[model samples]
Target chain A: MYTTMSSSTTTTTSPSKPQFRNKLVSSLNDIFVFVGGAILALLLLWSFCSFVSPNSTITFNISSPTRPKPTKLVEPTNSETTPPMNCAQNELAHDPPDHTFYDDPTLTYTIDQKPIKNWDQKRQHWLAHHPSLAQPDRILLITGSQPGPCKSPVGDHLLLRFFKNKVDYCRIHGHDIFYNNALLHPKMTTFWAKLPAVRSAMVAHPEAEWIWWVDSDAAFTDMDFKLPLSRYANHNLIVHGWPNMVYEERSWVSLNAGVFLIRNSQWAMEFIHAWAGMGPQTPNYSQWSKTQKATLPDKLYPEADDQSGLIYLLLEENQKWADKIYLEHEFYFEGYWKEIVGSLRNVSDKYLEMERRSTAGGRG
Target chain B: MYTTMSSSTTTTTSPSKPQFRNKLVSSLNDIFVFVGGAILALLLLWSFCSFVSPNSTITFNISSPTRPKPTKLVEPTNSETTPPMNCAQNELAHDPPDHTFYDDPTLTYTIDQKPIKNWDQKRQHWLAHHPSLAQPDRILLITGSQPGPCKSPVGDHLLLRFFKNKVDYCRIHGHDIFYNNALLHPKMTTFWAKLPAVRSAMVAHPEAEWIWWVDSDAAFTDMDFKLPLSRYANHNLIVHGWPNMVYEERSWVSLNAGVFLIRNSQWAMEFIHAWAGMGPQTPNYSQWSKTQKATLPDKLYPEADDQSGLIYLLLEENQKWADKIYLEHEFYFEGYWKEIVGSLRNVSDKYLEMERRSTAGGRG
Candidate 1:
């Protein structure tokens, strides 16, 4: 009786076990489907959010404003059949009539048809093809001025002759010259005129590599003197400086602005503009006065002027500006008017003596 | 016979006078022709020289480099028969696949076919067509950091939290934040770090109109305060200052750089670049030291930090920078760290009390 009861119980339990197993499998399948579907939905949502993110939206909006219309849309054909349009060709067709053409059509045809060529023509072709082989051109512009109101003590004709002599000297040395009778502004006289004159020359002669300003009072003592461009290739401005004055006196006039050379680049332009702001016309004029009083006690002149302004920049403002400025001590730039006159007389007497000697030798 | 001889002599004399007059006239004509030809030749030569002058040569050479090949030269056809190729249409046809189109073909067709008027759509179209109608967008960037190796007594996490809190406050007021942990360099820990961080932030986020750098030690006391962009529209940089400090002290630390705002314009970029050159790593570092020692005797710190650099710029550099910088003394930026800690507890207690009161009222 016990064996029969156990077998019946086993049979019922076996059926229940199979049913429970099937239910568990179905539940697992449902869970897997639900989780996969939920994940897919979340992924779609995340992608949509990313698509509309602020940065993406801004980019899209900006691009949309500039997007072209759809009317002229043309699908790109096979590259082999329809080669890309040459940009050079298109540009040539649309170019203005003012364009200068250097290419010789006959030469091109000859090169394609024949292998033989003259050495000269080959050299010419090479030169034409490689135009950038030449060194960068350097232009030196020498500028100066005589104040309109104050006639030079040496007389107007003598001053004019002096400037003309300078001009002739610059011309012989392959440098250009521009001499003005009036200041940039009537108010800017004496030392204040230097900044504007330099800036104006820079604007007027953009092709010039360097703009040099020499004061009317200054005379070229060394006719053989040539500003070696190679030496100043790395420098922006070159000014005469006495190291002794710089170290000991720390005088505003240590670096003379009576004669200076400035590179005609954007940096120099900006520097000149900054320097000009310290002039009497600017709002910082009072500040310049105070700075002069504080730093440069020897500057007796009430007007701060460009010299004091530059000294302020070198000593106090920014050392970067100071770095770009080359202090040249190799040449004497300044002499008193009286001393210069006496020297001029001695030079003329020497020239006269040389002329007389040459004539006597020719006569003999 | 005497009468015949007299007549013969008279005839000879008459012919000789005529011959002499003819010769003189011919010679004069020859001279006129020679002078005229010489003048014409000189004029032509001058014109040729002018054409080949340095300025003209430079212009020609510069233009020649960019001149396209003459292969696809096409004469513009009559406008009536062959319509002009629109630039926009050509651009659309050749546009890459990455381009996004915003033009709705249907909307354009509808607008053309049916002149139905909708004011809102019209206004939107006008707004879309005229984009310059919108006000210039302004973005504020707040940044700061403590260098590595200088572990704050207040934990790094706490300092980060403090910065994060400020960032949250700025976000609520419609601003962004960028916090750096490491110094730009190990040597840039003290004052040199400020310039590099500001400059890097400016470059990283070009979208920001203004970048405000608050020092690590500073905290935002006023949570609700919003920067008045309109007020600072004309200024490039804004700093905290006392009028008396600027005038009397003239000290490098007179104008605290704890909090400052800088514009993201080209001028500001250049200014920052110039400012960074005064850093200890730069060649001008020693010069900066000398300037500080000479100018600001009261500055006890040996390091020529950004603050001293800026003060040097304001007092001694170009005044244009001073004009752009606005000094504010309305609010406090830095207090003693201990005082700030004490104030934080008071603020927390006030907030807690408010929360308790609100919860009690809700329960009642």
Candidate 2:
């Protein structure tokens, strides 16, 4: 289960564009991405927007005629009778007289419905009303495993550690973590499960700015590491990969899809839909798989996977998606496990040394 | 592992105090609690205080000598440097220009430290500053398992489902859930592990009034069921058991300590220390185990356990803790698994039938 968690291949092309090589570009013959940890690719993310301009947005007008603002704060007379405990969950457990996106009647949280539009505007409008959630960056980490007990005797045990690692990281960082066991979409099994989960999370957590998706097998080796959110100010999706492998060699293993950071913007919603289109749940799954294999002759697998699907989007539709997709290699976002396990001692030592120096310098 | 999760046995002694019999009461001979789900006891919880008297409090006076009130709200200068994602985490992500418990420099969050005094006032003081968190009742659901992979290959898998079940329940109810894997106290293992975790949670979540601890093996069979907080308004700790078994029969399996709801109060702090005093981590482990066996002649086990420890507190120290500890047996609160599993279909049918009638009656 841990081995198959990733679906994206390595793509190391962020600045230098990989020349379009139609027939299995022979330039990527040496780069061999394995199945184990290769699938747990990191997708670095922030909404694809100008961070310098918060006012610049594509969204519904704030002045919606249908959503008239309530004149008084709404308090729960009896919370248990109305949706159990969820009611007016702002800072004071009360909703102000001012209206937010929740007052809108047309919004839907289901993934199968028509994709959400003007989400950035809706979230901003809601945040404006709540204000308590308006601090710069707030993230919700979403992860899950298969619905049932693992087929492998120790599979569930491995998944348990994987989950614990995440919980520990979140606890120390104060980030909210969601662990899912049910299949959101019945047909979207295996690698494709994350899409529906992410989509649902956006609607479920309007308070969150980013919805981070990490694979069940992708443990946070560095508990203290924090994401560099500032660098991905302009990009909407971030993944670790070698762009040359994806574009020049047309290799399916150019980028990984195991882990990625995604903003709760309309762009992310649309991107998820487009990426999930090549999954088994879709009618065009066979055609997409055939296209992927034909496009990247180096691809050994027969069925269209999420990693190949992402690579396809980056290669065939480079003008459309590549600019927004970040191929991060400056640091190990989600490095190979074998290499990382051995080097952890050295990494721990370095971090400790740094801490010692900082303490000595009175920075602690 | 599932069977061992429970430390307390059944006790039916909320109103009718069990008559004490020095030797084996002989009355509990027929009561044999098999381990499996007996350990999944539910501790129904609420702070032990007069629900009608909101202003009544026994705590440190609002006026403290050393801690001075701030004149302005504090915002995060740089969240990454201090503590990754935790800063001013009230409704507005800002602290008002008023003193709360956080202003007190002498307060400690660790369990080994001196017990917190006048916590009610401190919590009330903090609530006064952040009115948003001062709702009538707010609960934090806390659960966890062993740090490493499970000895039973399926134990971790079972634990995962148990956790996911909780997540689902919390998601629907809009409650915060925390899953701890690390041992809060290295010496505190098994049932005793919950002590340090619960103690730490009280400090971590000052916003939460109740800290609910449910064993990992205890799954939430009924997703829609909500705790009757009003029912436990005047109690600080709740569990399921019969009083006769504990006092009269002197049986070890009287009240279940598996699942319980404990309030965040000075009383709870003192109570936890008393309960944990009998664990292996304490110096009295051997003596307590020996005394427990002598006191409860029916106890088959020879080791000091949390369930027996809780019973001991209720038995010997009845005047000190019994009033605060509620014995709940009204419904299926962490009931036996085999019984619940077989009856689920019938239970579902009853709920559906009621729903059908309600819908017909226009309640839908």
Best by TM-score: 2
Assess each model's interface with DockQ, reporting 2 decimals per model.
0.01, 0.11
Q: What's the CA error at residue A286 for candidate 2, in Å?
A: 3.7
Locate the minimum summed-lDDT window of 10 residues in model 2 chain B: B44-53
Candidate 2 DockQ vs. native: 0.11
Q: Estimate each model's TM-score.
A: 0.30, 0.66
Q: How well does chain A score by TM in each candidate?
A: 0.55, 0.73
lDDT of 2 by residue, B257-280 (tens): 778899989999899878878878
iRMS per model in Å: 37.5, 14.3
| Model 1 agreement with the true structure over B1-364: per-residue lDDT tens digits | 0011000000000111113211212211100000100010000000000001111110000001001111111121222222222221111112121211112223321101222224224334433432322114334444444422112222232233234335434422334455544345434444455666666554434334577776543445433234544556688888766656766687765776656888766567667766766777666788878777677767765556676677777877756578888775544333323223334434444444544564455322
- In terms of lDDT, the poorest run of 10 residues in model 1 chain A is A36-45
Docking class of 2: incorrect
